[model samples]
Target: MAEQGPHFLMVGGVPRDWRDKRTVAEAVFNDPLPFLDVESAHTHEVLSSAMAAELVDLGEGIIDVASVRGRNRLLTRAIAGAHYSGVIEI
Candidate 1:
Protein backbone atom coordinates (compact mmCIF):
# COMPACT_ATOMS: atom_id res chain seq x y z
CA MET A 1 0.00 0.00 0.00
CA ALA A 2 1.01 3.62 -0.44
CA GLU A 3 1.16 6.46 2.07
CA GLN A 4 -2.00 8.42 2.86
CA GLY A 5 -2.79 11.93 4.14
CA PRO A 6 -0.39 14.83 4.40
CA HIS A 7 3.25 13.87 4.89
CA PHE A 8 4.90 14.56 8.24
CA LEU A 9 7.81 13.18 10.22
CA MET A 10 7.36 12.15 13.84
CA VAL A 11 9.58 14.15 16.13
CA GLY A 12 9.51 13.91 19.90
CA GLY A 13 6.39 11.78 19.60
CA VAL A 14 4.67 14.43 17.54
CA PRO A 15 4.37 14.81 13.79
CA ARG A 16 6.48 17.52 12.18
CA ASP A 17 7.25 18.88 8.72
CA TRP A 18 7.48 16.42 5.92
CA ARG A 19 10.81 14.83 5.03
CA ASP A 20 11.56 12.00 2.62
CA LYS A 21 11.11 8.63 4.28
CA ARG A 22 14.22 7.32 2.59
CA THR A 23 16.33 9.95 4.31
CA VAL A 24 14.84 9.15 7.70
CA ALA A 25 15.25 5.44 7.07
CA GLU A 26 18.91 5.89 6.18
CA ALA A 27 19.61 7.90 9.31
CA VAL A 28 17.92 5.29 11.48
CA PHE A 29 19.69 2.48 9.69
CA ASN A 30 23.11 3.90 10.47
CA ASP A 31 22.40 5.14 13.96
CA PRO A 32 24.88 3.93 16.58
CA LEU A 33 23.83 2.96 20.07
CA PRO A 34 25.47 0.99 22.84
CA PHE A 35 24.35 -2.59 23.18
CA LEU A 36 24.96 -5.03 25.98
CA ASP A 37 23.94 -8.40 24.50
CA VAL A 38 21.11 -10.04 22.58
CA GLU A 39 19.13 -6.86 22.93
CA SER A 40 21.22 -5.10 20.32
CA ALA A 41 20.83 -7.71 17.64
CA HIS A 42 17.15 -8.13 18.38
CA THR A 43 16.61 -4.43 18.12
CA HIS A 44 18.58 -4.18 14.88
CA GLU A 45 16.68 -7.02 13.26
CA VAL A 46 13.32 -5.62 14.24
CA LEU A 47 14.02 -2.06 13.18
CA SER A 48 15.94 -3.10 10.09
CA SER A 49 13.13 -5.32 8.92
CA ALA A 50 10.65 -2.57 9.51
CA MET A 51 12.80 -0.20 7.51
CA ALA A 52 13.10 -2.66 4.69
CA ALA A 53 9.38 -3.29 4.56
CA GLU A 54 8.53 0.26 5.48
CA LEU A 55 5.94 -1.33 7.67
CA VAL A 56 5.63 -1.01 11.44
CA ASP A 57 3.11 -0.72 14.20
CA LEU A 58 2.90 2.33 16.41
CA GLY A 59 0.69 0.76 18.98
CA GLU A 60 -0.48 2.63 22.00
CA GLY A 61 1.69 2.59 25.12
CA ILE A 62 4.61 1.02 23.30
CA ILE A 63 6.67 4.13 23.91
CA ASP A 64 6.73 6.78 26.55
CA VAL A 65 8.08 9.37 24.11
CA ALA A 66 8.73 11.94 26.80
CA SER A 67 11.03 9.64 28.73
CA VAL A 68 12.29 7.25 26.05
CA ARG A 69 16.09 7.13 25.84
CA GLY A 70 19.00 5.56 23.97
CA ARG A 71 18.11 2.99 21.37
CA ASN A 72 14.47 3.12 22.31
CA ARG A 73 14.25 6.60 20.91
CA LEU A 74 15.79 5.50 17.62
CA LEU A 75 13.36 2.60 17.36
CA THR A 76 10.48 4.94 18.02
CA ARG A 77 11.72 7.28 15.32
CA ALA A 78 11.99 4.41 12.86
CA ILE A 79 8.42 3.40 13.40
CA ALA A 80 7.32 7.00 13.26
CA GLY A 81 9.09 7.41 9.95
CA ALA A 82 7.22 4.45 8.58
CA HIS A 83 3.99 5.97 9.74
CA TYR A 84 4.82 9.28 8.14
CA SER A 85 5.60 7.51 4.92
CA GLY A 86 2.21 5.85 5.11
CA VAL A 87 4.05 2.55 4.86
CA ILE A 88 2.78 1.72 8.33
CA GLU A 89 -0.54 2.54 9.82
CA ILE A 90 -0.73 4.06 13.24
Candidate 2:
Protein backbone atom coordinates (compact mmCIF):
# COMPACT_ATOMS: atom_id res chain seq x y z
CA MET A 1 0.00 0.00 0.00
CA ALA A 2 1.13 3.55 -0.72
CA GLU A 3 1.67 5.87 2.18
CA GLN A 4 -0.46 8.98 2.48
CA GLY A 5 1.36 12.28 1.98
CA PRO A 6 1.09 15.49 3.95
CA HIS A 7 -1.14 18.31 2.68
CA PHE A 8 0.18 21.86 2.14
CA LEU A 9 -1.42 25.23 1.56
CA MET A 10 -0.36 28.86 1.19
CA VAL A 11 -2.62 30.30 3.86
CA GLY A 12 -3.21 34.06 3.92
CA GLY A 13 -5.35 36.09 6.28
CA VAL A 14 -5.44 39.15 8.50
CA PRO A 15 -4.48 38.96 12.17
CA ARG A 16 -7.35 39.38 14.60
CA ASP A 17 -8.08 38.91 18.28
CA TRP A 18 -10.85 36.61 19.42
CA ARG A 19 -11.61 36.38 23.15
CA ASP A 20 -8.01 37.36 23.91
CA LYS A 21 -6.85 34.79 21.39
CA ARG A 22 -5.38 35.41 17.96
CA THR A 23 -7.03 34.02 14.87
CA VAL A 24 -7.36 34.50 11.15
CA ALA A 25 -10.49 34.25 9.00
CA GLU A 26 -12.11 35.42 5.77
CA ALA A 27 -9.78 33.30 3.74
CA VAL A 28 -9.53 33.78 -0.02
CA PHE A 29 -8.90 31.15 -2.66
CA ASN A 30 -5.89 31.09 -4.92
CA ASP A 31 -5.47 29.21 -8.19
CA PRO A 32 -5.86 25.83 -6.51
CA LEU A 33 -2.18 24.99 -6.31
CA PRO A 34 -2.57 21.53 -4.80
CA PHE A 35 -5.37 20.11 -2.68
CA LEU A 36 -4.55 17.82 0.26
CA ASP A 37 -6.65 18.14 3.43
CA VAL A 38 -6.83 14.47 4.31
CA GLU A 39 -5.11 14.90 7.68
CA SER A 40 -7.07 17.96 8.71
CA ALA A 41 -9.64 15.66 10.33
CA HIS A 42 -6.92 14.19 12.59
CA THR A 43 -5.02 17.13 14.17
CA HIS A 44 -4.13 20.63 13.17
CA GLU A 45 -0.91 20.64 15.17
CA VAL A 46 0.50 17.77 13.18
CA LEU A 47 -0.31 19.55 9.97
CA SER A 48 1.37 22.75 11.15
CA SER A 49 4.47 20.93 12.24
CA ALA A 50 4.80 19.20 8.91
CA MET A 51 4.53 22.48 7.05
CA ALA A 52 7.12 24.12 9.27
CA ALA A 53 9.51 21.30 8.59
CA GLU A 54 9.10 21.63 4.83
CA LEU A 55 9.44 25.40 4.84
CA VAL A 56 13.05 26.55 5.26
CA ASP A 57 12.69 30.18 6.43
CA LEU A 58 9.53 29.75 8.48
CA GLY A 59 10.75 31.90 11.32
CA GLU A 60 8.97 33.11 14.43
CA GLY A 61 6.92 35.88 12.90
CA ILE A 62 3.67 36.57 11.09
CA ILE A 63 4.11 36.93 7.34
CA ASP A 64 0.89 37.89 5.64
CA VAL A 65 0.32 37.34 1.93
CA ALA A 66 -3.31 38.67 2.14
CA SER A 67 -4.12 37.60 -1.40
CA VAL A 68 -3.83 34.72 -3.84
CA ARG A 69 -1.63 36.68 -6.18
CA GLY A 70 0.69 37.55 -3.31
CA ARG A 71 0.98 33.91 -2.33
CA ASN A 72 1.78 32.91 -5.93
CA ARG A 73 4.45 35.59 -6.03
CA LEU A 74 6.01 34.36 -2.82
CA LEU A 75 5.94 30.75 -4.00
CA THR A 76 7.63 31.74 -7.22
CA ARG A 77 10.38 33.52 -5.37
CA ALA A 78 10.74 30.78 -2.78
CA ILE A 79 11.19 28.10 -5.44
CA ALA A 80 13.23 30.30 -7.79
CA GLY A 81 10.46 30.15 -10.41
CA ALA A 82 10.94 26.42 -10.73
CA HIS A 83 8.04 23.99 -11.12
CA TYR A 84 7.56 23.36 -7.43
CA SER A 85 5.09 20.84 -6.00
CA GLY A 86 3.10 20.93 -2.76
CA VAL A 87 -0.44 20.39 -1.42
CA ILE A 88 -2.99 22.81 0.00
CA GLU A 89 -5.23 22.10 3.01
CA ILE A 90 -8.18 24.06 1.65
Candidate 3:
Protein backbone atom coordinates (compact mmCIF):
# COMPACT_ATOMS: atom_id res chain seq x y z
CA MET A 1 0.00 0.00 0.00
CA ALA A 2 1.20 3.47 -0.89
CA GLU A 3 0.45 6.57 1.16
CA GLN A 4 0.66 9.93 -0.58
CA GLY A 5 0.70 13.29 1.15
CA PRO A 6 2.28 16.75 0.95
CA HIS A 7 5.46 15.22 2.33
CA PHE A 8 7.27 12.00 1.41
CA LEU A 9 5.21 9.05 0.20
CA MET A 10 5.84 5.34 0.81
CA VAL A 11 4.52 2.09 -0.63
CA GLY A 12 4.57 -0.30 2.33
CA GLY A 13 3.04 -0.77 5.81
CA VAL A 14 0.73 -2.99 7.86
CA PRO A 15 -2.60 -1.86 6.51
CA ARG A 16 -5.78 -1.73 8.63
CA ASP A 17 -4.40 -2.88 11.92
CA TRP A 18 -7.40 -2.61 14.24
CA ARG A 19 -5.09 -2.16 17.19
CA ASP A 20 -3.83 1.01 15.54
CA LYS A 21 -7.14 2.13 14.08
CA ARG A 22 -8.96 5.21 15.25
CA THR A 23 -12.45 6.61 15.19
CA VAL A 24 -12.00 10.32 14.50
CA ALA A 25 -8.33 10.86 13.56
CA GLU A 26 -5.19 8.97 14.37
CA ALA A 27 -2.87 11.96 14.47
CA VAL A 28 -3.35 15.65 15.09
CA PHE A 29 -1.37 18.45 13.46
CA ASN A 30 1.11 18.33 16.35
CA ASP A 31 1.42 14.55 16.20
CA PRO A 32 4.41 14.38 13.85
CA LEU A 33 5.52 13.76 10.28
CA PRO A 34 4.98 10.46 8.35
CA PHE A 35 1.75 9.51 10.02
CA LEU A 36 1.17 5.93 8.92
CA ASP A 37 -2.55 5.47 8.43
CA VAL A 38 -3.08 2.42 6.34
CA GLU A 39 -6.30 1.88 4.43
CA SER A 40 -8.66 -0.90 5.46
CA ALA A 41 -7.69 -4.40 4.31
CA HIS A 42 -4.62 -3.06 2.50
CA THR A 43 -1.16 -4.47 3.12
CA HIS A 44 1.83 -2.11 3.32
CA GLU A 45 4.96 -2.96 1.40
CA VAL A 46 7.32 -0.89 3.57
CA LEU A 47 8.27 -0.82 7.20
CA SER A 48 6.90 1.87 9.53
CA SER A 49 10.31 3.16 10.60
CA ALA A 50 11.56 3.36 7.01
CA MET A 51 8.43 5.20 5.93
CA ALA A 52 8.87 7.78 8.66
CA ALA A 53 12.47 8.39 7.72
CA GLU A 54 11.67 8.71 4.04
CA LEU A 55 8.95 11.25 4.85
CA VAL A 56 11.30 13.31 7.01
CA ASP A 57 13.89 13.34 4.27
CA LEU A 58 11.30 14.48 1.74
CA GLY A 59 10.15 17.32 3.99
CA GLU A 60 13.73 18.44 4.52
CA GLY A 61 14.39 18.56 0.79
CA ILE A 62 11.30 20.69 0.26
CA ILE A 63 12.44 23.17 2.92
CA ASP A 64 15.94 23.32 1.45
CA VAL A 65 14.55 24.04 -2.01
CA ALA A 66 12.46 26.91 -0.63
CA SER A 67 15.45 28.43 1.15
CA VAL A 68 17.63 28.22 -1.96
CA ARG A 69 14.91 29.74 -4.12
CA GLY A 70 14.51 32.66 -1.73
CA ARG A 71 18.24 33.40 -1.84
CA ASN A 72 18.30 33.14 -5.64
CA ARG A 73 15.35 35.51 -5.96
CA LEU A 74 17.03 38.10 -3.74
CA LEU A 75 20.22 37.90 -5.78
CA THR A 76 18.34 38.26 -9.04
CA ARG A 77 16.45 41.30 -7.79
CA ALA A 78 19.61 42.94 -6.51
CA ILE A 79 21.25 42.58 -9.90
CA ALA A 80 18.11 43.60 -11.82
CA GLY A 81 17.35 47.00 -10.23
CA ALA A 82 17.62 49.31 -7.20
CA HIS A 83 15.28 51.26 -4.85
CA TYR A 84 15.27 54.74 -3.23
CA SER A 85 14.73 54.25 0.49
CA GLY A 86 15.57 57.66 2.01
CA VAL A 87 13.11 60.56 1.89
CA ILE A 88 13.86 63.19 -0.80
CA GLU A 89 14.35 66.84 0.30
CA ILE A 90 11.84 69.37 -1.14
The C-alpha lDDT values of all candidates are 0.44, 0.38, 0.33
Q: For candidate 3, write residues 1-80 as lDDT tens digits.
A: 56666655345643566335645656458644343223312212222232345435434222223332455554323212
Ranking by TM-score: 1, 2, 3
Task: Report the number of clashing residue pairs per model.
Answer: 0, 2, 4
lDDT of 1 by residue, 31-50 (tens): 55333232344544444554
TM-scores of the candidates in the order shown: 0.24, 0.20, 0.15
Off by over 4 Å in 2: 1-35, 38-44, 56-90
Q: Give the number of the best model, judged by TM-score.
A: 1
lDDT of 2 by residue, 1-90 (tens): 556445432355323442237444556787645543333433234333444443445332222332212444553343332223444233
Candidate 1 displacement at residue 31 in angstroms: 31
Pairs that collide in candidate 3 are 12-45, 12-46, 13-44, 13-45
RMSD of candidate 1 to the truth, in angstroms, is: 18.1
The most accurate candidate by lDDT is 1
Q: What is the lDDT of residue 90 in candidate 2?
A: 32
